[model samples]
Target: MEEDSMDYTVFLEAKQLRKQAEDDAKLLSNRLALLRMEEQKALKKIEETRRKAQEIMEARIRNQELLKEKEEKERLKQEEERLKLLEIQNTKAQDRMQREQRVEGCKAKNRYEAKELKEKMQENLEIAERKKQEELEIKTNMKNQIKTQKSLAQEKRRLMNEAKKAQAREELERRIREQEQIRRNYEDSVSRMEQEELELIQRLQNTQLMQQSVYEDLEEAMRS
Candidate 1:
């Protein structure tokens, strides 16, 4: 009867130890499952970061292309303006040459008329003086027109330079902003990855400790 009682007690103790081991195993399995889930989440986050980085790079490339295109347009516009100024200068030069030729012809005709009208010297003198006055007026008008065109051209050049400076400032500011944003994003990704790695390491350490404790408990039960 005593032996039977001892056997029954031993059996009960063995059954209880088995139940505890089973519970511990189930808990460890659950922890491993949770760790796998966390790992999956970390991987997903890493992939998302990579995608964002790729998008940012593409955007930067596009911005560079746009900048180049704008610069080309500005260059073309400047060239066109230069050509227009040249044309205007050429036209002015032609008009001046024509006016000088007309004045010389008039002078020659006046000389012939004076020689033919020696008896009407006073009348010829008056006509010659009027012609000289008309020539002087034409010269004065031509000088004024040239001065006005020069001033207008200078003003146009100044305006173009100011516009170019403004555009350069804006472009520089935009590039700075983009670089700052990229830097922030990179730092954030690195920080997040480090945090996730630390968490995974800590979870693995905890699992190792739990396994060690379970092994110790099993060993102790066997000894008992």
Candidate 2:
């Protein structure tokens, strides 16, 4: 009965050890899965961030060109207004009725000049707008090129991370296999120990039985 109880205890211990190893394996698997998921999420965020940055840079360049063109147009308009005012003031300074005729010619000349100025202003505004549009387009194209380069860099980084993760996963698998082999080795040792203990107990019981039989035979011989 003692031998049977001892074997049962050894079996229970072995079972518990196996359970512990299995739990550890499961935990490692879960950790690996979580890490892989986090890595993927990081890669996706990097891509998105890069794309947004590119778009913002393009917008900024276009805005700058448009602003410069608008300022140029406003400057030309102000200059035209100043010229018109100066011409009007000059005619106002003339006084006599005979001078009125000469002033009238000057007035017609001023009107013609004002008309030319208006046309010139219009032409300048159109030119400025066209130049601004062209500049904006060029800037946008340059921004796109920059963005493409940056995106490629980000992709490279992401791929590197993925490669590292794969390496880690393989390493983890190897470690797990090593651990499993160790567990099996430990289990084999435990089994061998239990067998040895059982054999020792059986040998001790057999020795005790032989001594008891010898004493009984000696007692019978004395009675005879």
Candidate 3:
């Protein structure tokens, strides 16, 4: 009886241990299932976070490209403005140079005209002095002849008249030739002065036309 009871107790203990092991196995399985579900949720969260990060990165890159493009446009605009300002400065400088050249040319021409007028006045004075000397010599010769005595003077006068008439005719002819030469020289001087004035007018007109052309070109460029 004691041996049978001992065997029965041992069997019962074995059965209880088996039941406890089975319960522990089931609890472990439930924990493993719950851990798997949590792992899947973590994976989904990681994927969402990675997607959001990729989107953020793409947006940052796009923004950088836009910023660089804006900067480039701003730089190009500034460069164009600088070139325009430089061109304007160059044009103004050229205009000033042309104006100075015109002023200098006019001053030189005025000086030349004044010099020519002075020389013409000197020539006229010389011509008048020469004519006055010729008249004085004729008056002195007539006075000396009148002082000679009556009978001797009459015989001398008849001989003198014949020679005097021939000399008078020659003098008149020479005087006429000199008068014609003086008239020709006066006419030529007048014609030359007229031509020089015409040339000066033409040059002024040409300069004005050139200035107009430059202004028109500048206007066109500004419009463009």
Candidate 4:
């Protein structure tokens, strides 16, 4: 009866262990599912950020191209105006050359006008160069922004991976501890059972010896 009770208790413990294992498995599965969902969300966010960056880059390129086209048109227009002015000055100089007294004055006027036109052209070139530099800086800033976004995404992924690793490690440690405890409990129960059996055997041997001594004493008394 005692052995049967011990077997029943062991059965209960085994059942409980199985239930605990199932529960732990379920919990791990839930955690994994949640992590996967979060990973998907992070991936989605990264993709969206990339898409926006790509769109912004393309828009900026288009704007830059348009700006270049507008500047080129303006430059051509200025060149045309300068050529017209030069032609007008050449015609007036030719007319003044036909009159000796006025020739020097016309020559002076032409030199001044030429100097002014040259200064205007130089200023326009400087302005164009400044605009080009600004555009370059803007492009550089956009690239840096894209790079920063990429770095952030990578960091987030790295953190997620680390979190998963930590969780897995913790679960492994917990299972190991539980298994060790179960082993210890089993060993203790076995040791206790062995001790009890040894004690019972010793008691039985003592009881048999006492009975034999009593019988011998009875037999001797009858003979007398």
Give the top-scoring candidate (TM-score). 1
Model 4: per-residue Cα lDDT over 127-191, one tens digit each: 99999999999999999999999999999999998799678656655665666577566555555
lDDT (C-alpha, whole model) for all candidates: 0.70, 0.69, 0.68, 0.69
Candidate 3's TM-score: 0.22
- Output the TM-score of candidate 1: 0.24
| RMSD of each predicted structure | 37.6, 38.3, 61.4, 40.7
Q: What value of lDDT does candidate 2 attain over all alpha carbons? A: 0.69
Model 3 score (lDDT): 0.68
Q: How well is each residue in 8-92 modelled by candidate 3, as lDDT tens digits?
A: 5655555555555555555555555565555555555555555555665687789989989999999999999999999998998
Estimated TM-score per prediction?
0.24, 0.22, 0.22, 0.23
What is candidate 4's local distance difference test score?
0.69
- Model 2 spans > 4 angstroms off: 1-166, 210-224
Q: Compute the lDDT of residue 117 as modeled in candidate 1.
A: 86
lDDT of 2 at 163: 99
Task: Using lDDT as the measure, name the better of candidate 2 and candidate 3.
Answer: 2
lDDT of 2 by residue, 72-152 (tens): 999999999999999888766755556878878998999999999999999999999999999999999999999899999
What stretches of model 4 exceed 4 Å from their correct place? 1-9, 58-224
Q: How many residue pairs clash per model?
A: 0, 0, 0, 0
